[model samples]
Target: MIDAINRKIIAALQQNARISYAELGKKVHLSAPAVAERIRKLESAGIITGYSVKVDLDKLGYPILAMVQCKVYRAKEREFKALLLSYDEVIECINVTGEQAFLVKLAVESLSQLDAILEAFIDLSDTNTMMILSTPVDRALPETFIK
Candidate 1:
């Protein structure tokens, strides 16, 4: 149901969520009130889900970022997911297709901590982990689709 103006608003908000309504209005050629109304409608329609802040995990003492692909036993999927939910270190867990059932992203202070976390999952799943060296393209969404 999004029109060209709404698409522009979404694109602008994606770049900077903290943008003032008045400033955003200027960008989309609308009044502040109109901009606010459109944003509210977007939220009500469940398009604009939530806003978040990006943080430096390394500075926060979680220097190690690892991607753990887990091939969970069919009977143990629920148990494996329950364990994943308990850990604060688990930043993202995606249920995906392939040899792996779950792709988990973990941030930890050290290799020892990472090992301990992996040990907990070994009973229910076989894991293949890769430490992230650098993220050249992090969370890049297509602007072409928006336009």
Candidate 2:
């Protein structure tokens, strides 16, 4: 089980992953080497998977944000899954419970590009697309602690 200090380390990482081990030590009340060792152990145990940078897709010229629900035919699902995986515009895709087999999040430049991407899946799956106007709650990982 994770101790209290490890939880604090995780909280500190969530705030800013770019922080140096020496800087992180100050926040968690530990020495630089101690912090580094803890981080290594966390990674080895798979408690700390990896680090990432949060980016603004809109600022990067992808103005169109869409959530596409795809109800796929089981017989042709292999091709459908592979096709979606190949598209750069399709940023996120996950198997879902309700009416749809997969929920795909897309970031694209225009409606034409979105249409073209969807056309390829038409034969294998029935897709419902919803364009995102504004994201009041942008993408964030599930937070277990904050400190």
Candidate 3:
């Protein structure tokens, strides 16, 4: 049950969630209090989650970004999962099919740092590494068509 008003409010928020209630009210043709009420409802309904800023890892001194495909050897699944969770550099880890058991995307400061990180995986059978050159397209969810 997506109401037209809610859709418009969502679109506006998606554009800039930090917009003032008065400004949002003007755009949505409602009072500031009305806008606040609508936003509260949206938040309470779990439609609007917490906001986050997208960070540039390279500029922050983490210049190395690589997708390391790993094949866990002679391992129990519990230990493997714990090991993955213990590392801070590992932004994303997944168990997959094909030649590798897991693929890990890492953000590291340097090759030495990456090597240090990979040292933890000494027990792993083999790992295929591919360094990311450039991000051609980092797409966000489509909100323009919601209205």
Top-lDDT candidate index: 1
Model 1 lDDT, residue 112, Cα: 97
In candidate 1, stretches whose alpha carbon ends up further than 4 angstroms from where it belongs are none
lDDT to native, each model? 0.92, 0.87, 0.80
For model 2, residues 1-147, the per-residue Cα lDDT tens digits are: 477788888878887899999999998899999999999999998889999998888899998999999999878878988998899998899998887979999999989999998898798889999988887885434345422
TM-score of 2: 0.91
Tens digit of per-residue lDDT, candidate 1, span 79-103: 9989999999999999998979799
Report the C-alpha lDDT of model 3 over 1-147, residue by residue, as the tens digit. Answer: 246777777877776778898998888799999888988887887877766667899999899999998877765556766877888899998889976888999999899988887887766547788998989987545655553
> What TM-score would each prediction reach against the true structure?
0.96, 0.91, 0.73
Candidate 3 Cα lDDT to native: 0.80
- Which 10 consecutive positions of candidate 2 have the poorest summed lDDT? 138-147
Better structure of 1 and 2 per TM-score: 1
